[model samples]
Target: MQGDVFQADEHGPAEQPGERLLLDLDGFEGPLDVLLALAREQKVDLAKLSILKLADQYLEFVARVRQHHLDLAAEYLVMAAWLAYLKSRLLLPEPEPEPGEQPTAAEMAEILAFRLRRLEAMQSAGTALMVRPQLGRHFFARGEPEGIVVVTRSLYDVQLFDLLKAYADHVVRTSVRTLHIEAPDLYSVEDALRRLERMLGRMPDWSVLSSYLPAILGDPLKMKSAIASTFIAALELAKQGRVQLRQDGGPYSPIYIKAGGVAA
Candidate 1:
């Protein structure tokens, strides 16, 4: 079924042209991505670059992606709006600061810095996923019992960028209509995680996991920030060998957290 789907995609109207999805030494996801890529590729100052041409490219890129990938265009539109808004403002005449209010260069830098940070994160995940060998489990209908598979530390490491992307993707999921069940309040988990985040932490109990989240946020659009923020904090603790996530089996398994980090 999987092969058949791929074959259909290969020959189907949706088939991407050979040159499509291909990244040049610097061809980027969008104008912001392109600027960031160029900055990295050239190893030049991120500031002082002309935003005019880049802003135009940003608009053009959105239109191009829409023609090729409708789904991508929807998500890219958010970035497009941000660029267009910035471009429009930059085109306006400078206004005098009223009284003691001055917009510092640092503020402008931060506005542009977000794109650079996010692009780096996106690139790292793309590289990591590209290197991992494909597992054919989806190609088969069933799997025979096999020996335990062990993965060493070298195999895969998740990054904060990936966590943000995943959380964004998760938030974008459609909300469930069914009632949510949990023994504890979500604010409690948020408090716990936030507290644990400040000090290196441990794995959380698997059961009642929903308590860690706002039940109403089962939908995608609302879950991104909270979940993504939680995700990286957990992993940061794990990286220092200060925290470990433990899951007990069956109904007896107690899902609890522990601290792990250089300090732990």
Candidate 2:
């Protein structure tokens, strides 16, 4: 889970009453993951996830954790604090960032440097990949460069990924739903996968899995489901000694095929 939220009083026994049924916000990947789970749980408008209240509560919860647990969470706590800070700034009616503050030279230089590094790394990676017949491929022919475009934009073009910080902001202003109340299960992997296959007109590569899910489910969710369901089901069946997931097929990845399911 990502930037999720919960009041401190809500989590307890870590299992029996309020546990397992809902994800623990503290167990999230980031503030956004936590926010996404809350949005889905509350059925918040797909357009937004309350970020301010969530970020505030996140920091509060971090402070309240067992003294010992704080050490384990120091890094996460730091990030949570940052989210809360960023959220507060957004709530105020302000013109905008200071003129010079717009992508400071350091930030711009860093971004450019990062892009250059990526290009170089891509070249090196491409070369290394070509050493193995299974890995080599070029979407553009050798010595051909791809076109790049630059664009100016505002937040409306944002995808779910862009909302992590946004969610942290709204969470403070609007209450974040706690999983204290019961919510009926929505999509189980069992049903979700079936729906996905139907949506795609076929079972698809793990990468394509999320495209069939709700936008809130998002691309990252689909990628995760692909990796999880494929491996988990394969593992279960493998224990029964029936099938195994093999990744011998280039970029297509592994599948659980019966011991004799495929013949070379």
Give lDDT per model, in order: 0.53, 0.48
Give lDDT: candidate 2, residue 244: 33
Number of the top-ranking candidate, with lDDT as the measure: 1
Kindly list the per-residue Cα lDDT of model 2 for residues 1-264, writing each as its tens digit: 322223223344333344223334355644444434444454554334345555566566556664423232344566666666566555655454586665533343344335434554665798897776552353434577878898978657777877897888888878766667766434345654444334433433333222344433445655565556544544554465543345456776444243323222
**lDDT tens per residue, model 1, 1-264:** 011111111122345445334322123444456557545654544455555555677677557545544444333467677667777767776676677875543355466766676677888999999777666743443467677989777665799999999888788785535797865323333554575566442334232322344444455644555455455555555565756655556765544446542322
Candidate 2 local Cα displacement, residue 76, angstroms:
1.4
Model 1 misplaced regions, further than 4 Å: 1-35, 38-44, 98-106, 114-264
Candidate 1, TM-score vs. the true structure? 0.30
Worst 10 residues of 2 by lDDT: 1-10
Runs in model 2 lying further than 4 Å from the true structure: 1-27, 66-68, 95-98, 103-264
